[model samples]
Target: MFSSDILEATVTIIPLWDSVAYITMKAVILDGEWDPRPEYECSETEADTHKSNNGSQTWKHPALHIENREKPTPESDEVLVKVRYTGVCGSDISMTHADGDRYMHYSAYVNLPNVIGHEFSGEVVETGEDVQSFSKGDLVTSEVTSYCGRCHMCRNGFNGHCENFEQLGFTIPGAFAEYVAVPEILLWDVSPLEKAYKSKDDILKAAATIEPTTITYNGLFGRAEGIRPGDYYAFHGVGPIGLTGMNVARAAGAGAVIAFEPSDERRDLARELGFEYVFNPVETDPTQAVAQVTDGMGVDVHVETAGAVAQTYPAIDETLAETANVVHISNAGEPASVDLRQYQANAAQVYGAEGHTGDRIFTGVIRLMAAGKLDNLPLVTSIFDLEEADTAIEQASKRVDGKVLIEV
Candidate 1:
């Protein structure tokens, strides 16, 4: 009966029973709520256990190190992943800095010093006795959330909104470290990596890109469900997500995918990735550019992936067609004003898209990688070790480069 909410990245845990706990971030249930709580604070023995086995490492929190004295034992349905590589995203940066009091209190209570990376790949070092679908030593990537299968949202296959969802990096400790225990249902056998990829580096790069690509896939193809072949598509903000949208739009049969990126480096990358055309919103009016590109007709589908509030309405103004379908997938913090009357009169449809819940989008990206249709390796420009997590976070915040990978 417990439910938790991670509002604005703040983690709050509410106990519905003495043993059961809920993570508010995604409304996931922790079934062993009745488990007894240890009343003791960090003991010397407990503190001693925190040191790395190598014993020569100087540790900070990974960002802020609060000791998690308890190591969770895997349940019968879980498998333990010996994490290898993890990728950081913009949201992780936001949470790390607590850009606002926004969700600070909640996150403090729940996600503090959370093993923070979500986009990751690993090997199954152990499997629960009851885990029938996988075995130890299997290569895999986790989908980042666990959901109650029987819930209304899950029954509808929108498990991302599972009334009780356990998000890996937030609700549960994630794969930022050497290991993470996840349910068997959330594990995918990525062995035969060669069967699905041309090289280990390629697969690792795909692993980094899949999470962001899935966001775009879920946003464009998932939300604007009717997007069909030959639809004109435009995406604002050619960051990782926007660039991924370029590939997705093309693959989905969009005649052309115009990427608007203010960053010259990103724009160059987008052009290199086969985006038919790329523009710098800073130098020219993207709307005007799109109009010219489309022969004065706005695009049929418009996606706003730039996490900037100021650019949103402008992007909307530029891309929406007479009967446009626009999906807002960015997580901009402030409220935005829109002229509903204009949208209504133009016969436009707008939908808000969020994170992925299951492996559908994840698998989809993997399949794309396997086919060599999506190039993710180019997107990964830097790599760092787990100990340099703080530096990685700092670099990611700058967004001056491409995706950053952490070797766990």
Candidate 2:
């Protein structure tokens, strides 16, 4: 038995081997917490201790560095995952730049020297004594945000807004490494993918895309009073999340799925993916175009996946049908001045949706995927090795194309 104290919590581990052993694995670490203090403000002893434990040294405060860390052992109720593939998200790009004032301020739960990749899929290599839902060799992906079950929001079934929430890539160590330890409650059993998919690589790729799809699912179903079968759906932005929204909207029996994108590449990609009514918002007026397509009835549902609130909010109000629901899924940052007159005139409602309700949404997404309704392989346009994580992030940050994955 092996036991260690981390952040005042006692974690117990049972080695897979009969003998005690230590293994070092590669990881990307954000060297310091979001503190206004200078790099030199950290004591030499503290830095030295961190270097000794994590096996590398860096002086760049709030910067990402590649290092070797001892493979973490799972605590009771947790499982150790051998990461296979991880997805790079827009939030990861923002966090990489360490937007201390705006975005990072909202993510105050993030700890220092954290490992940061949240959307990942892997095989379970080990399980703690108290872990009952998973076993070694199980294929899985997990809900990165964990909530304290006793919180008022959790008790009220709003776990995504739990008063006490800690996210894996933010508040603690995440899956941008060879291995990660996560609580069992957050684990989703994707082992069924072994049979559902054509190959292991296909399953891993699908699993890596699950988190983003779930975010879109939550926005459409969980946050927006759910979508109806014959509703006309409109999406602004043709990026990964937006494309996923298109697929999900179709699966939900949307009468029509329309998209607004300025990028020719993205518009072509969407057309290739079977979207017939895509328009260039820069050239064609979004409201006029949507009205022309819908016979002036306007869209039943409008989703803003583009992070430009100033642009998307107006487009939504212009294109929304009477009694339509507009859901904003992107993190545009700060409040934008929206002309609510149109929305009020049309009796439309706007909702700000963020994060998924953990496994609940994950289960729904998985079911959709299994039934062949949520095919995301077309969106997995880029892939890189674990060593090329920075490049992967760079590609994703450009926002010029589709989903990017880092194969661990």
TM-score of each: 0.78, 0.85
Among all candidates shown, the one with the greatest TM-score: 2
- Misplaced by over 4 Å in model 1 are 1-63, 66-73, 100-110, 150-152, 191-196
TM-score of model 2 vs. true structure: 0.85
Q: Write the residue-wise lDDT of candidate 2 on 322-372 in tens digits.
A: 889998887765587777898889888888898886546888888888777
lDDT of 1 by residue, 1-408 (tens): 333444523333433442232111111111111111143243353244331111112122223442323345578999877677788777567555532322221121123335666788877777788999888767788776688899999999887777666678765777666667899887766654466677665665566567778888887766776787887888888776787778877777787788777888888888776666788887878778888888878888888888675766766764677888888988775687776776887788888998765646767766776666776677777888776777887788776666788876
Over 4 Å off, model 2: 1-22, 32-34, 37-61, 98-109
lDDT of each: 0.67, 0.80
Model 2 whole-model lDDT (C-alpha atoms): 0.80
Cand. 1 TM to true fold = 0.78
How many residue pairs clash (N, CA or C atoms closer than 3 angstroms) in each of the candidate models, in the order given? 18, 0
In model 1, what is the error at residue 39, expressed in angstroms? 30
